[model samples]
Target chain A: MVAINIDRFVKRYGALEVVHDISFDIEEGEFLVLVGPSGCGKSTILRMVAGLEEISGGELRMQGVRVNELSPKERQVAMVFQDYALYPHMSVEQNIGFSLELARVPKAEREAQVKRVADILQIGHLLERRPRELSGGQRQRVAIGRAMVRKPQLFLFDEPLSNLDAKLRAEMRGQIKRLHQTLKTTSMYVTHDQLEAMTLADRIICLFDGHIAQMGTPHDLFDRPANVFVAEFIGSPTMNIVPITASKAEGRTVLTLAGGGEVSLPDGTALPSLTNDGNVLAGIRPEHLSDTPTPGATARIEGVIDMLEPLGSDILVTMQVGGATLTARCTDKGQFQAGQNLTLHFDPARLHLFDSKTQMRLG
Target chain B: MRRLNPAAILMLVPTHLLLLVVIALPSIYVFWLSLNESTYGSDLTFVGLDNYVTVLTSSYFWRAALNTLIVVNAVVYIELLIAIGMAALFLGGVRYPKIMFAIVLMPYAISEVVGVLVWKIMLNSGSGVLARTIESLGFGMFNWSVSPPLALSVVTLISIWHHLPFTFLLIYAGMLAIPKSLYEAARIDGATPWQEFWRITLPLTIPAILISLIFRFVFAFRLFSEVWLLTAGGPARLTEVLAVYLYQSGFKYGEFGTASATGWLMVIGSLGVASIYLWAMHRRMLKGND
Candidate 1:
């Protein structure tokens, strides 16, 4: 096992700087996921760590040794590409044993390692077949098996499950998590899917536009996001952001919502000091909005139902409140028709305030 | 659903009829004439299979067949090697690839007569650029056209050079179509550059190579321009390929029956080679899908 420490990493493609200076520490035997949207340079960061890409400026140390100039093979790392780039001419057995063959391991030992990895992946029967003969899931397993035979200290996965269908992706996700658990090798995974990041990562590194947005455990990211981007990106159905204008009405601060409404703030909840009584963006996740029809300061908005998507265990309901669109997840399956008025409630503590100009979350 | 239009078939009918009149008629007439004994435009007598039998039994017929095979084999193999090597070098980040590729393809774009004439001038015995260069390098000037084997080799080399660009372009396109991720994966698997080329690059290019082979083999077998222009089957008819023999016997010697029989044999041989190649390609494609 080896711990990886990356300090002040930067990458440039000619003139455009893709990965801005970023630093993070990866614990030994941990599955760290880097999550971001397209063009955010998340994959670039992972590729630099894998040594598939050059580090423009950084210190990448593996077990206390600087490995910036090391080639991919010399770095002792294995990568599972997104396309599952198995050698089409080679059979599954040969693909798994390729690295061992290159190392000139004895044929028997190569066979033994291939067999063991194949058994763990439950693909022993597929060894005799070529990549073209296998299904997507089967090919993904062969790709993983190919990596496993190398027995490298670090494993890098570049959206390996992205090509699979939904059910197969879920199954493979579990298998990968199990594999990481059983093998206990330090691994880095990159994905745009928040669910995969939340499920597979021991610590998730959220990135936005080549910068580290936040890095923490799944609970830390979900419960206490450092900024607006993390708050909106980490959850499904997205967080609803409402623009409000703050004003002092008779000494008690009241925030004016669009379409004519004001929510008077309690004495303890002062206006964020960063912005001077100007416009602000308030955020609330869909799950945090409750369906119970009680009245409270946080439950000030009344809305007309726009759409409803029932997900068996939960029903996702979208509603129009004033100028803002709010989504709420209700466990009850009561028929909520379009144009029906409904009262939505939420706790004020779960609400997030951000400066509208800079988009930075305000405490 | 829309019905098929009668006008669409009407538009195709004239071309179909033209094909029958222009192409099908001559093909049938050739088959008919091959079975008859005819000297120029004089007395055409039906001789059944005698013409074929006479051509098949002739000693020169066997020699022409051997020469044809030799020329085709030499040209195809040399062209395949040159094309593959040129493509690899050009695609491997050589300076000014487009300019180099255009220069290599210049021979193929030129008329075959013009191409062969240029090579003839360059390979001429004493005063040619190649011979003079060899002489300057301490090698004596040698007559390439007078020596039968050397003449055949010279024709083969010219054909190789002329046809190389076609194969190179095809294989290069195939190489480009392959995803770069495969090479990345191979590198991560610890494969050396040579091993990557052999294991990944070469095997993936089988489809393109097969296509180039079929095309070059068929054309090389019936090659006439370079051999005719450079050597003219000279110094004892050592380089008299099947196509040249057909032209010589029919046009020069006025032996239409024997020439037609040889032409028929050549067609059958080329078709046989084509079918065998197609069958192999099908099998390989199916095996890949397996």
Candidate 2:
């Protein structure tokens, strides 16, 4: 049975539909993330699931019970807000135990449960301190602790780590994933940061223009995005997209990059039927473009280096290849300089092709 | 931090000198006069705290002090409740709350003496609307100004009418400043409506509450315009609060020394209340919370 099932969930703010009819099911103990850019209605969907927002047109069921009309309290869910929403007047102890107190649980049991959750989050020492007295990460932990102490049927996290600093955000991202693993509670998270979705989600729903562009595991999304949007949106230093002319000649597909380069497909490589002379958008991830030629490289292109950014783990190089700029992530131990001409190899198997008019994946 | 520029310090000297001349000088003179014996036209004689001792022991002074204390507490507490209720209603998405808030603030916009005069006429025993309405309701001739409790209640009502808007606006703005996400979090935590208000709204608005409390408290403690303009110390000094007494001592009875002493006492009383509230605010801040 599904833990949370949203059937044709629609959110319309007075004729302007923010989220078009979108449907997805979350399984029990699943860490589902709705990932999108800002204003993509991802947070709206999470709010609808949490019952904080009314489902404008849909049937919502939680663990087989229809909850469309249920108040947030009756929905039996807990949410961690992006702002940490730690009651400034509440001590960590009170904040953690707040849900239990609202339930009118006995004080001794409330204290015990608060302590138990505090121990799990490693916030035992900060229990007496107010949220103002705690650091950002500590406040985040207290926020998560507050949600988890309820042991609710579902957890909704609405960009809960977005307000933290970079280092704290990454650390808390891992901690949240671990918490989900330990509890195995059905969870729905909303975030605009694809990295967080990649790191933490069991399944990710990538939203675009109010609709689900694609939904899959991080591996599936990174490896096989449904369209150009998904392909570009999923990866960091995202997939390089450029229009290319395609044609069938002598039973092999030939391509000419709009940026002024050519590559011929290997024989017997299956591809969608191509017009004699037609244009389609081509997508290649920076990771797939190599600074050095590979043994089985399908094509090689020459270009001058436009710029270089050396991130500690990898070097990201932008090359003025063909007639366009293409970013390539390279870890070539050899030193490279900007404005130098170089040839970068590409493996055709990792290439993504999308129909220009339809913007849908073709090959 | 950058050191203060000498030019900036030099620029501040004029304003500080003005404040010393306009405020500091007169206040020192008042304290000096309180330590001496003087009448409206008599030469000052050094008496060394005799006026303070006399005012402290006088029954009328105690009565007026009690009246001031009662009025301040009654006005602040009542206004606080009304402000919170109105602010909550406005924030609860009552339609046209802005217009309603503006309407409720009408009394505050009116001049204090004018407001008092309007209420005085409205409560007039012979020709007032309130008196006529009460009389029509079989209360006989509604002589409200003579009864101590009723007279004080009238003053309290008018004061609340004048001051409710300020406290309401402060609390309302504070309520607005609270992130909507906190309410969402509370709802998902299974809190009832009452719990949400008590836990989230009240505690989070403590700063506004403290600020409005101090402002309303001290302001009400120094009440004079309404009391003097409406009732003029009333039938047998029943509503003669500290400010009215100060006015009566200097202007009516021509007791300048006693009046200055009363003025100093009023300042001390206001500071006492303010310090308690400020101390509580500081203690809460130190005890931890944003």
Q: What is the lDDT of residue A87 in candidate 2?
A: 80
Tell me the lDDT of model 1 at A363: 80
Residue-level lDDT tens digits of model 1 in A26-145:
999999999999999999999999888899998999999999998899999999999999988899999999999999999999999999999999999999999988999999999999
Query: Which digits, one per residue and each the tens of the lDDT, describe model 1 over residues B92-198?
Result: 67888778778988887998888888778877767888877877888776678778788888888888878888888898888887788989998999998888888
DockQ of the candidate models in sequence = 0.66, 0.81
Candidate 2 residue-wise lDDT at A277? 48
Cα lDDT of model 2 by residue, B10-125, tens digit: 99999999999999999999999899888866899998989999899988899899988888899999999989888778877887766876798888789988888988898999
Compose the digit string of candidate 2's lDDT tens values, residues A1-363. Answer: 578889999998898999899999999899999999899999999888888888899889987889899898888898899898888778899988988898999999999999999999999998888888889999999999999988889999999989899999999998998888889999999999999999998899999988999999999999988998899899999999988897778877777888677766666666665433478888899999887778863666678999999987789999886787789999957577999997778888888888888888885
> What TM-score would every model get versus the actual structure?
0.94, 0.96
Best by TM-score: 2
Candidate 1, lDDT over the whole model: 0.86
The candidate 2 chain B region of ten consecutive residues with least summed lDDT is B281-290
